[model samples]
Target: MSKVVLITGGSSGIGKSIGEFLTQKGFIVYGTSRNPENYPDSQFSLLPLDVKDVKTIEKTVSTIIEKEGKIDVVINNAGAGITGPIEETPEAEIKANFETNFYGPINVIKTVLPQMRIQNSGLIINITSIAGYMGLPYRAIYSASKGALELVTEAFRMELKGFNINMTNVAPGDFATNIAAGRYHVPLNEVSPYLKPYGNTLDLMNAHVDSGSDPNMMAKAIFKIMNTKNPKVHYKVGAFMQKFSIVLKRILPDTVYEKLLMNHYKL
Candidate 1:
């Protein structure tokens, strides 16, 4: 039987491209979207799912299990981006960020773990971000959310080792995706100190993505991760600068890393 793969946020961008690429590679790929119709033409199956809603998550996974009988791999790729200064961001927005980027993936993981455990063999690939390691300036909440998931991924990997279930984090750098168009931004008026810099930095970041690496590279990286006998805890997928920055963040002092970030993002 072909390996059954489930990916979140498969309607467009990285998620969608990965699903398509995997299907071409002969995997039975199923993808998720809040609006299934929006991705009706995708090569892979598009299922409706809202990561924040337990019922929707369970139903989607159940539907896949019923049809495929087994889920060999799951890519927790469903997430959104939010941008703003820490102070200006509302409590609700921060919670929403965690809801989509953090808790959302957890919901799916919990739902699938039971089955993966029963099978005694499976892979859980988390599409994390470079920001998860080094928090970005304006995208504070987004970084925090991904960082939290990275911790969970680490702990879960240790706990699930005995079950033959593999867990890994695939941190993709800025890829040329439609995420920039859909990213959420906090409303900053004249009173906000961050209003001016926010616009300039966000635009620059968007352009960086526009000129960033190909989403196909991300898909290829994930393909390698999926087939590895025992994948490592974390893998960085992106350009030289992004990968180097992640490496530098690990070895560099906090002050030095912060300075690098400030200069790179023009903060």
Candidate 2:
């Protein structure tokens, strides 16, 4: 039987690419967006979903299950980004980022776990980031959010092992996406010292994102993990150095790894 797959935050970017790719590969793909009216119709089903809303998530999943029978794979691709100094970030902004990036995935995972456990087989893929492995300068909240999700994914993989459910945290480095347009900015006051430095840092980050390789690369990695009988716990998708950075973090000392990152960002 074809796999029934559900992907969140599929309005555009890597999530959308993954959905389109999976559809071509014959998976029964259902991708979610906050507004289904704007979702581009395709072989993949576009359903209304806002990861932050538990009811919407529950309803969307149930709707899919009622039609597709079972969800074989759940991809937590929905995310939010924030750019600014941690100190200047508003409480509401921080909460919003966590709600969408971290808690959102948890909501999806918990909602699907029972059904997956009963099926005795399923895959849960979370779209983390290279930033998750290490905290970045301006994108403090975004990095923290992804890092939290990655840790959660790791813990759940072990806990769900007995049920034959697998988890893969795909830590993508950079890809051309509209994330910058949606990223929240921490309001700065006239006396704020982080103003200029924050602007410079954000510019550098945007340049890096613009230069990022195609999102399709990440999509291919997702497909690989989905098809593999025994997939690894973590997968990094990006340029050579980006993937290497993860390895470097594991082997290099904290100070050394951080210095390397700082130098790369010209900080």
Q: Which sections of candidate 2 miss by over 4 Å?
A: 187-191
What stretches of model 1 exceed 4 Å from their correct place? none
Quote model 1's TM-score: 0.97
- Residue 222 in candidate 1 has what lDDT? 89
Steric clash pairs (candidate 2): none
Clashing residue pairs in candidate 1, if any? none
- Model 2 score (lDDT): 0.89
Per-residue C-alpha lDDT of model 2 across residues 1-267, encoded as one tens digit per residue: 999999998879999999999999999999999987875565578999999999999999999888977999999999988888888888899999999999999999999998898789999999999999888888889999999998988898899989999998999988888887888877655688987777777788888889988999988999989889988988888989988988899999999988987887667
Give RMSD to native, each candidate.
1.1, 1.4
Number of clashing residue pairs in every model?
0, 0
lDDT of 1 by residue, 1-267 (tens): 999999999999999889989999999999999999876678989999999999999999999999989999999999999988888888998998899999999999999999998899999999889888877889989999999999999999999999999999998889999888887888767888888888778888889889988899999988988879989998988988888987798899999989988887777
